[model samples]
Target: MQPKKKIYIALKFIIPAIIFLISIGFVSKKQEEKLCKKIVITIENQQGNFFINEGDIMDKVTKNGREMVVNLPFDNVKLKDIEQRIEALKFVQSAQVYRDLQGNMLIDAVQARPIARVFNPVGKDYYISDRGEILPVSERFTARVMVLSGSFFRPYLEKNLLIDQAGKDLFNFIQFIEKDKFWSAQFAQLEVNKSGMINIYPQVTKQIIEFGSVADYSEKLSKLKIFYDKILPDRGWNRYERVNLQFKDQIICE
Candidate 1:
């Protein structure tokens, strides 16, 4: 309870607290000192528009191609705005932006996948993906995807994409089929009959495979595999020009 003893105890606690505070402040100061001088941005399948918009935290930063080094007075530079701006492109599917300890920023993203190539009535040819999506041509991004033919082939209107009930059914059916792993790579194109019936044409084998609808894509795909692995490999593509799997658990190949 003596005054000097009480003072010494207080000094022991206060000295350590002050030293801890000073160490934290020094580390923080060093982190801020490592602030980046610029920001780097790169986009894939960008058709020439490469400028990140203003109000972005990365503006006025130094750019070395896609690598941006942002000059930050603080330890962090918020980059959500910059990412959103870059991903606003109709062609861009998703965008990711991040900053390292050195204030270096990176933008990486993958474009959307196109499902079907369409021949619109406007005499313009474009591609439409599985989500009922449509887009113009791209020389740089022509995927080895599927081709579709029906009355649904046309320009993208804000209205309905299907020309009739048949087109809609066929689109849905083929989209599911396209997602199939065993059959998708083997299939080349899909054609819709006026009766809303679906068909699968193989990439290696040239034949018209008559599948009813999306209802039996899994089953029909299995049958198609048998036709290719068991029959087509031995008999050649011309052996079965018309492969029909309309009946239950049966594949009638002619």
Candidate 2:
């Protein structure tokens, strides 16, 4: 082919490509300039927890008694800022914010699941999330979870409880009960004494479970399970006033 013909073919393709690129940029700029017309908030409550509601999330996204994203331009709406504001709520585990092509802002939030409710001796009450996050008790809702009460957990009210080994052990012990179907239903509360010994209370039974410290919790629980499965069936649930699993290779019942 001749040099002029070759140049003509190259220009034909390059010119259209440049035009398409510019058209895309212009459309994107127009989209950004458009005003947000609507806001949609969705709260995921698969766990049936009502700690936070739609109104609470809207309050966080609103400023000065107005919705931040509704009347603002797409470019001015900070999605990350909105997300951070929603996630700041004690019950919200995570939040996501974004804009749709229809000039509407959408927010999706997941609420935290409380594994245990802790009532300290100093009158500080809180909830411990499954991820070890300390959450404040909500006046609107109460979770049906295991309870923890005692002076041993009082120091954690003012500081990060999950940072220390003792705290971690306590959290792990709660997790163990929460994970087990039978134990979670049987046990209602765990009390830590001054000497760091743990006593568990059952919902149906009248006996106290002297679970000792958090050390060897798995083995202790195993023994307790055996007692329930084998001994309780024959001796009856109320046969013993207290069941001690602190001893090695022996279950002391009284």
Candidate 3:
């Protein structure tokens, strides 16, 4: 009976001490949370859109972000607001905001990818992104993609918007050329007129290529490839001033 009584008394004191320790830990955690320290901002360069910098991102965040993030507790930080503000930047394609275990703000972002550059008829220039949206030209970097000039212009509600259907068709046609190794290196410039006639200037040969319309594009490209592989080598590339691939089953050398 004596041993059992001692054991019960020991357990009572140990349990109270344990409860006090737990309460102390909980209070420490709450106190640490209330102390909002430095405003740490991290911006990830996912797609290499070098138009904007980390300072630019933090400026956007602090200017329009929730004051709770910088002044109040870390738990009061508005993550979605930060994300939306960052994504609203002209070059930012997407952005995500979160807090780490140490209450540091982390942001992961991707920049818009430009696939083509368009020189409008009205003497304006912009980039066409892979997602088909129009992007403003960056002062930092220039992409060595396909360039379209002349009267190939499409109306848009805003400058930084997707190309219209007709413009997309033309853009896709240029994309096809860019994807092909031979044509990409050979075709330097693409020009289209108001009548929808397409002309291609090659880097290798002096002959102008009259591509006409986008109709029968695949067939026309196939024929051009055949001429490059079989006929151009034999007949000499300079023999023809112009190569017409507009017709269905004929390669007219003028």
TM-score of model 1 vs. true structure: 0.58
Error of 2 at 181 (Å): 0.8
Winner on TM-score between 1 and 2 is 2
Each model's Cα RMSD? 8.4, 6.9, 4.4
Error of 1 at 17 (Å): 27
* Cα lDDT, all candidates: 0.62, 0.86, 0.75
In model 3, what is the error at residue 151, expressed in angstroms? 1.9
The pairs that clash in candidate 1 are: 36-70, 36-71, 37-71, 38-62, 38-69, 38-70, 39-68, 39-69, 40-67, 40-68
Task: For candidate 3, write residues 1-254 as lDDT tens digits.
Answer: 69999999999999999999999999988767555455565445435546777877877778734344554575566779878988998778888887666756777777777766778756568877766677878777777877776665556313533345666677677768767887789887788876668998888798899999887789999999988998899999798899999988999888
- Badly placed stretches (over 4 Å) of model 1 are 1-36, 41-78, 121-123, 128-133, 153-181, 193-196, 230-236
True lDDT of residue 144, candidate 2: 92
Between candidates 2 and 3, which one is better according to TM-score?
2
Per-residue alpha-carbon lDDT of candidate 1 for residues 7-62, written as tens digits (9 for 90 to 100) = 99999999999999999999987876578644555555434333223223233232
lDDT tens digits, residue span 193-220, model 2:
7667999999999999999998998899
Clashes of 2: 0
* Evaluation by lDDT, superior candidate among 2 and 3: 2
| Top candidate when judged by lDDT against the true structure | 2
